[model samples]
Target: MTEMLQFDFMRIALVMAVLIGLTAPAVGTFVVQRRLSLLGDGVGHIALTGIGLGLLTGSSPVLGALVVAVLGAVAIEVLRARSRSGADVALALLFYGGLAGGVILTNAQGGGSSLQSYLFGSISSVSASDLYVVAALAVVVLGIVAVFGRELFLLCQDEEVARAAGLPVRFLSVLIAVTAAVTVVIAMRAIGLLLVSALMIVPVAAAQQVTRGFRSTMLLAMGAGVLSAVSGLAASFEYDLPPGPSIVLLALALFLAAAAGGTVVRRRRARRAGEVVPGPAGPGERPRVDAEAEVISG
Candidate 1:
């Protein structure tokens, strides 16, 4: 760790990784609660087209990605608000379309090069300018979440209730979507588009196993993500592996450990209480699934 810091680019990657690790999970907590986790992937796919265009034009791909990602978020919200198909369907359409367009454009302009770096990741690929752009965006994302914390929590709990209580669901929804887009762009630098959502999600999923408050989960997830980033980089440097995948693998291990630990704790608590405990939850299930259902029904 000390030796890697000697290089300027390594320092930049480390700083950017910490920023992305902290930021992704902060926003992801709300995203997971609202079941829009896949939105990250959809927006990333759309951002690819812009990244390709940027490469072709010899401009900053990150800027191109940010612009396209915001537009993708807008398109998603508009489609979602239209009552056309379900939210998942709308995201799926965008995901495929964006990927297809990105592939075509990139292939036409630049022989479809560097797709792997965009899809996977190369921490060394980030430059000082990339660091600045990501840092600025990270601040904006964190600020928005901080300022609208209450309203966003409400939106997570129930969009309709938030709307009924005059919380500006439409505006908040757009705000959150755009914020998520920014998160995706930042994450793309560390983990790449294909696995960026994992950074946003897996740590939060691990934190959820402990059953604290929503805010606690978010905090825990941030800690977990930072740990994963640092440790993953360490492992990659030691073993000559890819940084992003290594980080994601560590996060998965954490998630599994948390799930197993939570199961053991829950069973013990049930035994002490002299009540039969429910079976362990499936991978697909999340915390407050029943409450969210009630909110939906009501």
Candidate 2:
């Protein structure tokens, strides 16, 4: 088992995992706060259309996917601008549209194998070239995230307030969406269209469970994502599981562990302060708060 870890395949997976770990949550933080977890799903599936087009034209699939994903993001913004309904409807339309386009194009061009890779992902088939592409995508993703960190936070906290404060909300929103599309494209290499959304959702969700502050949550989420990537890649190599699903499950396990630890700490502190109630929580029963009394008593 130890000897297996030193192989080139494992090494490539590790490098790819590191690149994915850093960018997934960085972009994911915004995606989560935007209430657009499905955005990744929508854009990722749409990316297949781009890959199909690329395969037909003998272009790079990654670049093609990136282009298609960005177009999808732009289309989303345009749709939101003109509509009164929620973004969910827009997402559904885009996803379905892209999926149909991809299927048709692939069938027409006789490139089912190439399209299959984009649709289902073939992480185990990753080559050194794929790693290089992912590394480049990581840099691009991180650059965009860093450049707009403040704007993203503003949007997340309160978009209306940000607009009132002259934060260019529309442009920022489009920028964030585009960044998410790019992240999804990069992650698709390892996780596939079916599961790439997990990379954006799991780590940040877990981090938010433990951290109240935004900075803390982002940092913790990034750490958790990196850990999951490393552990999951190792698991896939050792246990012959799929990489993307393994990473997601590892992340979920971490979340459960964190939740348990948080619960224990909160309860212990409450008990130590003699705040334990005599009976169990009732239906819609609120804890009787004696804030001033408790403070004085302490």
User: Highest TM-score among the candidates is held by which one?
Assistant: 1
lDDT of 1 by residue, 1-298 (tens): 8988888878898888899889999999999998888888789899988888777787888888898999999989888878755866767888888888777877877654478788888877788998989999999999998999899999999988898899988899999889999999998977888888899899999999976599999999999999898788778767878888999999999999999998988777667545323346465776655645464456
lDDT of 2 by residue, 206-290 (tens): 8887775787888888899899988887887778787778888998998898888778776776786574443454445454344
Taking all chains together, each candidate's TM-score versus the true structure is 0.87, 0.84
lDDT of prediction 1 = 0.86
- Give the clash total for candidate 2: 0
| Residue 128 Cα positional deviation in candidate 1, in Å, after optimal superposition | 1.0
Error of 2 at 133 (Å): 2.2
Off by over 4 Å in 1: 84-88, 271-298
Off by over 4 Å in 2: 107-116, 266-298
Which structure among the candidates has the greatest lDDT? 1
Model 1, C-alpha of 260: deviation from truth (Å): 1.2
Ten-residue segment with the worst summed lDDT in candidate 2? 284-293
- Report every candidate's CA lDDT: 0.86, 0.81
